[model samples]
Target: MLFPIFLLASVAAAATGVIFKPGAWYDGLRKPGFTPPKWAFPVAWTIIYLLSAAAATRVAGLPGAGAALALWAAQIALNTLWTPVFFGARRMALGMAIITTLLVTVAAMTVSFWSLDRVAGAMLLPYLAWLCVASGLNWRIWRDNPAVPRPAA
Candidate 1:
């Protein structure tokens, strides 16, 4: 019951990537040398989404789950916002800010979930690791691309 709902929410958040897309703007950015290959993005995100849903499902009905679930919702909302800000609006700095906030929120959520269910908290470890990579990538892009090309009027 709860798994489907959580999965649906995760899928909806993931949908932002499809809608905004990297397209040419992202391709033109001065990516860090360590940037993951283009194919890795979707694959990694797929796994993250599945893990996030599972983690949420594991903790949803447990005692004292409210604050942790709130963090989950907040992180997902931030996740949904980052795609459009970075890909659609081409704002690297703002994207970095949002991702940083997401990282903190997820970390807090992980610790909270850990208190309720260790496995659920453990499931979020990969997500936290991925977010660190993503945050570094965003920071590098923002630092490297100072004079970003403005979208054509």
Candidate 2:
């Protein structure tokens, strides 16, 4: 029921990454030695997204889940914003901002979900971990490509 819907929304958010792929612009930029391979982005994102959606679904029916669901919405909205800001517009700084917010919101959701359903909270553990790596990558990318100008709005 809600699981599929949540999953679909995650998939929709993920599509933005595919549509606004890193391409030559991303490839040309310097990345951290620890950056994961290009192919790993989609694969990792797919699993992360699905797990997050399931976590949301698991807690959606709980009595005080309104706040948790709201956090979920915030995280997803911020999640959707990152791909466009970072890749589509080539605005690493702005992308970093969005990703940072995403990291926090996801964390908030994680705690909220945990309070409601530990399983749901646990489901997002991987996403929280991944976002840590992603935030570092975003910061490093912005640092490495200092000369690359931010795209015009």
Candidate 3:
């Protein structure tokens, strides 16, 4: 049961990427120097989400797990929103800002999880690390592509 929940959460996380599949929508932007290959995102996120879910499941029965779970869910929602905002909506600047916020929220949530169960908290470390890398990448993308108009609406 726990495995399925984790799998589904990872899949749910992946579904967000579907919004960016139409290459026409993203062809105009300049990628950062360190921008990862297209194939990397899906693999990285799937693993991260699965690890996060595993960590979370271990603490499923804990007293304060609800708050930790809520924070986790909120961060995931924020994480999912980033792809659409950046790639689908083409709002790189706004996406960078949002990613920054998400990064902080994930950090806080990680600590919350850690307090509840160390293993669960540790499970989130990879995701937090990736978000830090991502935040830097997002800022670089915005900086490198200064001329592109911010998405309207």
Which candidate should be chosen as best, given TM-score against the real structure?
1
lDDT tens per residue, model 2, 1-153 = 899989888988988977988888888998999999878888889889989999999998889999999999888889998998899988889999999999999999999999999999999999999999999999999999999975676
| lDDT against the true structure, each candidate | 0.92, 0.91, 0.79
lDDT of 1 by residue, 1-153 (tens): 899998998899999999998888788888988999999999999999999999999999998999999999999999999998888888888899999999999999999999999999999999999999999999998999999875664
Between prediction 1 and prediction 3, the one with superior lDDT is: 1
Model 2 has a clash total of 0
Model 2, position 7: C-alpha lDDT score: 88
State candidate 2's TM-score: 0.96
Ranking by TM-score: 1, 2, 3
Count of backbone clashes for each model?
0, 0, 0
Candidate 3 lDDT, 1-153, residue by residue in tens: 566775677677678787566275455566666777878877888789888878878877789788888877788788878888887777878899889889888898889988988888888898988888889988887787777765577
Per-residue lDDT of 43 in model 1:
94
Candidate 1 stretches with Cα past 4 Å from truth are none
Q: Note each model's CA RMSD in angstroms.
A: 1.1, 1.1, 2.2
Clashing pairs in 3: none
Instruction: Give the top-scoring candidate (lDDT).
Output: 1
Weakest 10 consecutive residues, lDDT, candidate 2? 144-153
Q: Which ten residues in a row have the lowest lDDT in candidate 1?
A: 144-153
